[model samples]
Target chain A: MSDLTQLTISQARAKLRGKEITATEITEAYLSAIDRANPALNAYVAVTGDKARDMAKASDARLVKGEGGALEGIPLGIKDLFGTEGVHTQACSHVLDGFKPRYESTVTSNLWADGAVMLGKLNMDEFAMGSSNETSYYGPVINPWRRSRLDTVVMPTTHQGDGGFVSAGGTRTARSLDNAQLVPGGSSGGSATAVSAFLCAGATATDTGGSIRQPAAFTGTVGIKPTYGRCSRWGIVAFASSLDQAGPIARDVRDAAILLKSMASVDPKDTTSVDRPVPDYEAVIGKPIKGMKVGIPREYRVDGMPEEIEALWQKGIAWLKDAGAEIVDISLPHTKYALPAYYIVAPAEASSNLARYDGVRYGLRVPGKDIVDMYEKTRAAGFGREVKRRIMIGTYVLSAGYYDAYYLQAQKVRNLIKRDFETVFAAGVDVILTPATPSAAFGIADEDMAADPVKMYLNDIFTVTVNMAGLPGIAVPAGLDAKGLPLGLQLIGRPFDEETLFQTAAVIEQAAGTFQPEKWW
Target chain B: MSVDLQTVKRVARLARIAVSEEDAKRMTGELNAILGFVEQLNEVDVSGVEPMTSVTPMEMKKRQDVVTDGGKAADIVANAPATEENFFLVPKVVE
Candidate 1:
């Protein structure tokens, strides 16, 4: 049998259907990988091994009877933010530590229907706030690849004196917790880490403001943030309600496409969910990209970006150019305002959405002398410093005195950013190419916790525009940096144009070549 | 922008969160730092530009004024921390 660790969904499904492999064996392989990887990486909060095996057994039975589905027996990781019936969906916050929902999210159900096995719930940043996974109460997810020269390397952890121990395949130890090692790109960092570490084929993730794409980029994995309303948001914990959308993080474009197809469905329960027809994303698999027009957004090249990132962007352009696609230089003039506008709009919505967790309904309830005291105590103890910071900002932005000045103006700016994308797309820009992030993953300690929070927020600068515009965007591995860390190139497509984006990404994937990171972790 | 601790205290009250004076001082420092970063927005020329609302251009969908919710009240209240005989229990507000 070939390495199940490196098998794509298409290859796995084909093998499963041909009776060359059983679903149980495939799932066990992924589970074994999770067991090997999760101890050091801390990628998952829960590993549903028993349940996954049971599901895999049923899937194998179905395949034996010639009744197979697209995701038949595929192993998957669920982001903890999505409610799993009777499972802990804490969203990495202590407030909902013991809270379990009675209903499963529509997206999880859809994937299950396609025969995907739930390996377990993956960790995420608290309430999907931070760019790095350090905010997760379950702890940070370590990056998979060791720093190396080749696109893929088998290297050792860099700041090893902190606390990293020798890992599998007989790798040396690193102990750098005191120096705060680089987090697996977050708030979906756990999912990214899992896929990169070969723990699972792919995992469900949410992108409010680059939560999905940024982490994928940081981890050198492929992440796709679909058009708003492309996937149902019902049962996913609210972060910034209007901006949040569920997506997928995977090892490659093809893996992401299969996961996206299974996850994209309409649900009547979620009012924000679009009732439009779901596309067969797999149909575009292996499609030609000869006549495609790829846009290069000049605005994304922020001042002082590491020269290597700019070079990586150029390298991606050259690859696409060689693949017979026209690369057009374009401008998203309002790009500069996207971060501020997103901060305002997302918080305003969050202020209202989170109002329900005031110690009266859901979340931790602290005892106090009176009802008002109860509200105050529960929330203060339940929420962490970062979560509280966002809530306060959310409340201030939505307050009556500040509403017109902050919230209303933010709404207006939101429109401008969206219009910027629409105007460019209207002008024949099929998709936009840009750096996924300004810098590669920095050590968690390198970020001065005392420093300005806005600097931390700036990390989402390049990816936030897609969220603001309600467009589809993806991060694919472009190349590695001088330090040997992987760098990602982002592709932003027109609304509902993920098909073209995937084909273009596939072309780049073929050109830049497959990522073969040296086994570092 | 050096936000004062007093302002942090006020912001906390407005945000319905309780913070001690020490925490307020720290938060003031943090908020000021964030605001300082946000102040960079002042440099951009957004004059005469319309602000954004939703990422998608579509207006919020509206349905008929008729009530149509199908969620069962019993099921919802069943999970509440405090409930009376068929209703949610809450602190008495009006005498």
Candidate 2:
């Protein structure tokens, strides 16, 4: 009766089990929504229409037999970083041009085995490098949420160069071209955009230094980056092996909890995947955090952080305090160092991991005079400016003379940052609370961020610490900014303690009701 | 920590990615800006701190040394930019 794409995973699951609607019906609703929205949003890079329908058809049959998984019939978007087995899985980079993997990512396979239907591959920052989706060779994903209260001032497309950013599904759309779009935060921008825009019921996203949570905060959705080893990274394109973890971006914390349960697992294929039972995250949803201790780290009070963001953090503390959560002031002195450390560490690993795409195997290749020249040309042509900058930074930091100064120092700083979290958590802190981003979403490729790329890197200042500490963190849409753009509050939990985050975030979400952008698309 | 144009070239060569002279000049500034930011790590006293490799305390996992997967060369090479005889094709390495 209603547009099924707007239903949360839990809501859709109940309706499917009650036989009020079939899986095909809901999947169709999402597909139709994508058809209408994607051209403007650039949220989906590849739409697996036939595969989705086939999965839904199978799900419909299973539902009739009274057998359905937790997410049976839920149409979800998979971030392009995840290998989807014969579908596009390029990590939204041109170097990975037209390359589709023959095997599914362990996280997606886990989602599939539990009956989640893939709507398509979502776009992202190339190799999950940047804070805004602009790094994506496919162009930036337009966040559905606009700057409210303004007469629509349409600006012609500015960044349309050789990227072949084909909007409107390979055809130009007037509305998209005319509007000055705001960026969905990266590197999980498309996933956040799709989930927030109701294009997908949920999305599988990865966070290598705040990719998932930052984008979630920007788009006003719930995103949780599970503990580093909680989800097997076997098939998810490797970024930073130590910091990268797969997570879910969904309409609400409950849906994030449900999706995360199905996405996390132990796998022998990945040596780093934790050998432990994946907890039932939904079981703790809505549970009272009566005696929970929430820590507010004094160190997170960085210079130049907006007055509104600080107010939001204080308001989040008040909400939890009202809900019986004990608010305690704590300090993570190494918090300021997390971003610099993450930059050094993430790219260092990215350079090593991305070296695999040297024209010898897969993706784009530009021929040259000889093998050495060919490698140089292929990578030069394949990678975008952001990717190249990172590769250069990574190579420079890990160079023979600079290894200790940059790479090793970053690793040491990482240890200190992790120690700060461990010290706080050891003080009986149940969870730590902070603003998700310095501010709400900015306009795509805004002059400020583009002038200095580090301005973009500063977007992850709050969220990157979670990755550095190897802890589970969730961003809950707390309220709106002065401009009516959604702002999120992040809750950081102990290692493998996602249940606490889910329960705590639910309280924050309850006090601060869910938000969705006006359907301008 | 300031990156020079020559250093950018050396690193680009090391990374095996072609950097045009002009782009290399641009990269020198960007790379220096990033490095200048990362130089803040020098402020922390990490004298005794071990450079952490693994976030979770786990040893290197080992399995029985055996062929877990093979015979999927057809599928594996499906994504190759160029291939011949089921192997990825590249420019000739030997003269």
Candidate 3:
């Protein structure tokens, strides 16, 4: 029982199958842990304890009868962005706070079919916009790591901050002077924090840009953003529709592999979801990447990357080199254009996708004197500042006058960025390696985002390239920074070649060793 | 490159979100900074090169032209914020 909390999804399933532990027991333990820790972490936005208990009890019954699902008895937290039938599926925004759905998302339905027990929905940025979870209507999630008490307050600063903050949770009150609170990373911060703290074995996360991967890196976990349309985006709350893909965030590569297999499926409900065959991802785990070609994209070198991150990246290269994988120095010359292209293209799509949230259709609505007033008042109050900024930018780019200059030019540049990968893959590059984020997690109140918006956007420089090229990118925790916060190495793969990506990432994982949660899990 | 705060307010209105005047000023500076960061693209020599839109050159997959649907129009309409007699209700846009 003491060790059950630390077991990965695969280990838990093995134990459950052997009858060493009942599903009921596992579910109960997780519920209790949630009760104990969730108050301080603020990871979950909603807990379906009654529903999970019922499901777990049935799974236990089935296991007793010699019928078991692959992931039967495993408790998992789902991001609130995924629509769940008969459950509130708010995207952690005030607009959709009370909105419940009549149907479940395709991803949730797929996970259910795999016999995963629903723990609850985790919190996220308002419509998945901010890098930090502070923009979430639910409030900022506290990191689970215990650090020496520092003299600080957790406030959203102008630029990003590195120091931890004060927790509004009772644990903070009880041990107020004992531990320091750090940023939990976002917009999938809750998912990252929850998994890191062992609230659940894994969680469902969506990435439009780097929402899933960046948070995973920041929180010291493994998160994979599969190729666009690899996982159906049917039930995901739309951010930038073409860019949004739901994937798994877990403790290790194997867990992520298992969860991704369970979540990917073809659905007629979503026109964009591919009808390709879901691979047996478990079979692909731990494969040797010897003799494989890994590309080190020459363009990812920014002007002032910290020496520590640069060293860790070199260390990863050393490990891969030792494993007999050939590291090719490749050039993604169009890399510089990726961020600009993404900013234009993502906003254009987002502007169109987010138009549905008008006062007339769905999500939030505020009554006003007239229809125009209603639309104005509802949107004016419903969306957050970042969302508004993005929407404005998106609309501006896609507008008639500026369309060619911003949107069309961006699309043209997007193709060039995509070509960078195409040329590399054509030249025998299997996977591309880069830093997950420009730097490690910064403090929530370190800088005013209002003042330095570009510095804030620069955080996604290493990430947005993959999205622009529509390739799979996974972020695995590589090492710690000068301030002791975790940094991550990102691996980008050719479309639909996740097996190579996973195998190569495992090689890095083998070298770096499994992420040992220092007091979080 | 200097964007007026009034334009920021207009953009905010079009985006359907509220932005404080202070936020507008901050966003202008930030937007300018981002534009400056993106300006590095001009240094790359990509003359006569076709911009790549997708990593894989696979064309969009074809589907049957026959119409198919979940037939849950009623359920979808039920979820709409404003509906009237099985139709999505909107403010009359026609003059």
Tens digit per residue, CA lDDT, model 3, A1-521? 47577899989989999999988888888899999888888999899999999999989988999888878889999998999987878889876746788788989998887788999989898888877887888888876653333344443334335655543432221222334576766789899988988899999998878888998988889999999878888878898876788989999888999999999987667666776898887787677778888899777888998887788889989988999989899998877777777777777787787777766645678877667767777877877767766777887666567665666566667777787788989998888888899877776655665466666667778888888778899999887664557778999998988887788888888888765546643
Give a tens-digit lDDT track for model 2, residues A291-340. 89999999888899889999999999999999998999999999889999
Per-residue alpha-carbon lDDT of candidate 1 for residues B1-95, written as tens digits (9 for 90 to 100): 34577777877876667898888888877766665555545555556877654556564666788878656766565455677765876566456
Candidate with more favorable, higher TM-score: 1 or 2: 2
- Among the numbered candidates, top TM-score falls to 2
Q: What is the C-alpha RMSD of each candidate to the true structure, in Å?
A: 6.1, 8.2, 7.8
Between prediction 2 and prediction 3, which has the larger DockQ? Answer: 2
List candidate 2 segments past 4 Å from native: A150-179
- Worst ten-residue run, lDDT, model 3 chain A? A169-178
Winner by lDDT: 2
lDDT of 3 by residue, B10-79 (tens): 7767776656778778777655565565555555555665654444455566678887767776777666
In terms of lDDT, model 2 sits at: 0.90
